[model samples]
Target: MSAETPGPRRSNYSSMPVAYAAIGASSAPDLLRFPPAESTPYEETLQLGSGTERFLTAANLLMTWGAQRVAGVEVVDIDPGEPSEYPGVHFTETGTPELGAAREELFTPEGEAYLLAGTTASFVVGSKDPRRILVVTTVNESNRLGFAWGDRDEVAGYGEQQLTVEIREDSTVWAVARGFTFQSSTGITAGLKQRAHVKEAVAQAQAFLQALAPGAALRNGVAKPADEPDENDQSADDQPSA
Candidate 1:
């Protein structure tokens, strides 16, 4: 037990074996995950409803959808367990749902359930009628909350891809999606296609909140801002009708 004693000098056990798999695994996700095909960053801001209380509630709920796992495209299992306490509770006992299945997936679970980071999936935004799936990755709501896949999964994208919906106190909200980086002209062209779909999805989300706001035109069930002109005609109504 001497500190410097050369007792039992076993060459086999003296040096530890190199583990290539574990060592290289660190950057595996980065190599496989979605690479910036182009640099097409997108950011848009729009005024929702002007109501103080109501607007905040609606926007906040949108954020909560991700946390509670309220939204996502999931098929009902034959054994639809107990009814969820949350109204319109849609969840799957197994399998990770689409990234933005409902409005957004606020909370990312601890397990990857066997998936690649860039594995694309259809995402839906807002609770708009017919939550359609749009272009998106297979990751969860953790993106908006600034979470990454590799955090939970051993091998996942560095988690660079993201979409954020910031709801301010002023009732004006803004959204941003990290577009791809451009390496070449072909990559730029491809990135535009992806950006196009992302833009549409975010817009739908904005519209959903716009309609849900208090000042939205409840008369016709269409969400119209108070400042927005009448649908019949935005023209000068000041002149007397002929």
Candidate 2:
């Protein structure tokens, strides 16, 4: 499934509900299950605060694209030139969460579930080049909130990422991030670049967890970098004065 544009690089968003390379994989809670055999896979999980309030807070933040913002990743919507031609809901370049607009335009029912299916945007991670992606799957159930995206027109490789927050029977909340990537580009530097790719992917997931609870220990037990800032720390402006 592909869409034609004026440029050389085409978009994969035209397929809507199944735009990504590995479709329907992120829809399930366990991403480890039917893995993309060719791509390298990684999973990261963190125990967020327990209870309903914590779960709701994290869900709302994720639904609003707060995780990307916290990861220092810039998300810009690609203008399809003709808005009407584009399918499903899409965000503005400002990356603002317009759930009301999505509900009204996309005919999404008014309820707690918030799945922005078929959203397309460009993500700029660090100083590296931008990677275009489409939202292929989203889970917005009573006890879970998550979305998955796939890389589009990337020169280095193709990949899919799933970021989700779930609550257990005992009300213990958890954050899970997982993804797989397969590099296609070839060159003397390609091997080194792919290694960076995995690291970046892991770091991206870690950022999502850290954003929710800075300085919180990872369930995988990976050590945090020495210079990682504790966003949970109260700034001077955040402190109350006498």
Candidate 3:
């Protein structure tokens, strides 16, 4: 269920250095192949335990912004209303419609709110400020699920982050996060900002991996048997009377 190829130079993405340049390059062998000129790239991949369930769980967390949430960053979804005019292809459906619909129904409410191209979200990282970005590309193939985004001029640098989860032929599920960025500041300030950015990126990537590791699915939406009590669940005795 691939989306339409994005149109060139859409007005909504003028703020990015080269909008959509890194669209589908997130999982590429080489990150440099499609990044904006001169931007530095980074990537991290975690091997999730093998299974179809693991892949779906990881993908669900990703679509719901699990990485940012687990890393202690706040996510704010920016609504664009119906017939969204934001940049990039807007479809989130992947693989065949049946499979895509199944995943969507499982992860999102009403099967209509999964992340898609043109969707926008802001990551509020501490008191500094929120970084808003627009999705530029998405992959919803049978074995792979991922999405990439471009900076929306809300941050100090222009860049993007791509997140994906895939199941190999052997049924091994892997989670990956990769992106490119260049500080907009100059001289000494730029150096400091770049280092900080790299640190934050790596931290968030690790959080993403941790969110999908073994035993993570329970908290992430995988159902636990009704007879078993979740450690995090509050017992009736612990609740105050309303």
Candidate 4:
């Protein structure tokens, strides 16, 4: 193992200036929401591709709770066992015309072949110090998919989030996450807050396409930074919006 590692804590800044790290490095623009406060709503969007079944199919992988076990994250509880486990890990079909009215192709209700509108699951983010659980509130494929338990469990605040990926009439495929979380988590430390959970979602969005179609270059969505630099349209930092 190397003597140095990447994590939330470090002493490198002890001998240096600027509060444990370079201001530019630690103060990267958070494309989530700014003026971070309690009960705030955050959204991050990404342009994936043209509207088509192919893109929706890629998104379906996320709704099916399959991506939770991907490269950087892993499912912690995503299986149906007993009723005592009221919040049993399971996927239920949210019948959309895309899957047929009866959703037969989705498999028997008790079958493990698919996920519907109400499907939900849980997962952890980091390998060394998995901090919080990402919870799902809804998983309606191709129509309306969302989450209702992340910001609450994470930010000492509470809110739900939904990711909508759809092709517009112009054939542009867009994926966006809309959610609410408390402005400040009571117990979480400073470095952790700076991680920007919204950014993680954005990365996950990109990963969806990467997994479905490797080498695909998903475009980043632009957000208006909370603060613009004096006399300059850009923020105090030169970083572009993610």
Candidate 5:
């Protein structure tokens, strides 16, 4: 007899309850897998501290949070204008209305991590300027932050020139300080004094963050709804109508 060829095999599988049960049994654990835990509000609050401490900590925290969150970091030493370089750092001419100075640079990985982890903004008193100055800058995001100054001779009169720092989208930060005679308003002294005020404001903001949330990431000082959902993927039925 000639050898017989085997025909195509047919699967006897059907919607058998036992087989279905077995299939479900094998897959059930997958459905039970837990989702990743989210960062707690308390933890987030702790990440963002206040004052020089907070500023430093927030800068450091940003490294892990994301690049966009960090932006940049600046530390202004408002003394009789000393040579501006941080050792392993670079600077470039920003611009000015008159005879002033401004610059910016990138942070190294160590610097980025350190700032993101936590660092304190430092201030030093300068002899030529005779004013304590604070340096302010971003932490980890990018090089798009700047500083500026303005001043007036009369204490009661408005400011003449406004010192301004601007970070363009292209990752350039600049600063300018100037003095002029203008109508009454808030006047700032173009040089060291204006720098000092900027420092003070930064310090105050830092302290506020620390006191508000010791270790939480500092939120950008932008307005947001109090009861907004944490994630956007939720369906319309999942969210309350505005």
Candidate 6:
């Protein structure tokens, strides 16, 4: 998505009826074109004073699109930005009509299928780190999905993972958690699936960042310098004993 495309402007649900269709036409095609590939992982360093909110927002947009299209799920945008009664948990409602049924459908088997599909899409969109730092699971009843981001201490330093569980009235659920340490210093070099999504997500994030801060670089994982000084710079006097 181009920065000129606009940022989270009033949700695209109205203009676009089928969310999946829009994603397939816009972002999916690009992702399919440049699939992720594994190579020597290296981090992309951002200039000091860079803001990461743009990247996070981009990621959220992609996740929203994928979730809507793949699982037929809609993320709830709770105003006031306050924590819900569930504490750390947010709520969204979904329903469908039964052919001749009126007042719109709130829960149904079809809705459940849509939720499952959307969850898969959301997972694919959010899953970037090749280390398998994130895992997505499904819950049939209660229409909820669970995501488990594994403990970070296992891979990185003292860090904690994030877990997100989503449920729709139709009994569709999506859950995700931070599983592994993601090093931005090493660009995603895992495999096609990993690289493609990450690259696209990163690119989209970059676009958003550029808009937010023209020259600032948004760092997602770890930051590392690209170029190292030549060994010749080390004087003989400074050389260590062989």
TM-score of each: 0.29, 0.63, 0.67, 0.45, 0.17, 0.20
Report residue 67 deviation for candidate 5 (angstroms): 24
RMSD for each model, in Å, please?
18.2, 10.9, 8.8, 17.9, 30.5, 22.4
Worst 10 residues of 2 by lDDT: 1-10
When sorted by lDDT, best at the front, the candidate numbers are 3, 2, 4, 1, 5, 6
Tens-place lDDT digits, model 4, residues 101-169: 222224212232444322334556665433343333334444433332332133333234454555567
Q: In model 2, what is the error at residue 122, expressed in angstroms?
A: 1.4
Candidate 3: lDDT of 117? 64
Residues 68-100 of candidate 2: C-alpha lDDT, one tens digit per residue:
756667778743222243333322334322221
187-208 per-residue lDDT for model 5 (tens digits): 4644445445434444433443
Looking at candidate 6, what is the lDDT of residue 131? 25
- Candidate 3 residue runs with Cα over 4 Å from true position: 1-29, 80-84, 87-112, 216-242
Give model 5's TM-score versus the native structure: 0.17
Candidate 3 clash figure, as a count: 1
lDDT digits (tens) for residues 1-242 of candidate 6: 22122211123455321211111111111222321121111112122121232222212222223222222223232121112211121112221111111111122211211121112111223434322221112122222222222211223211112223333344333233221122223345534444454454444333322322212212322121111122234322211111
Candidate 6 wrongly placed segments (more than 4 Å): 1-45, 48-190, 214-242
Model 3 C-alpha lDDT per residue in residues 111-201, reported as the tens digit of each score: 4245666567777878967777776666676788777777766355556778888899998999888876666667767788877876766
CA lDDT, every model vs. true structure: 0.28, 0.57, 0.59, 0.36, 0.24, 0.23
Give the distance in Å from residue 12's predicted Cα in candidate 3 to where it truly belongs. Answer: 11
In candidate 4, where is summed lDDT lowest over 10 consecutive residues? 18-27
Task: Look at candidate 3 and tell me the lDDT of residue 68.
Answer: 62
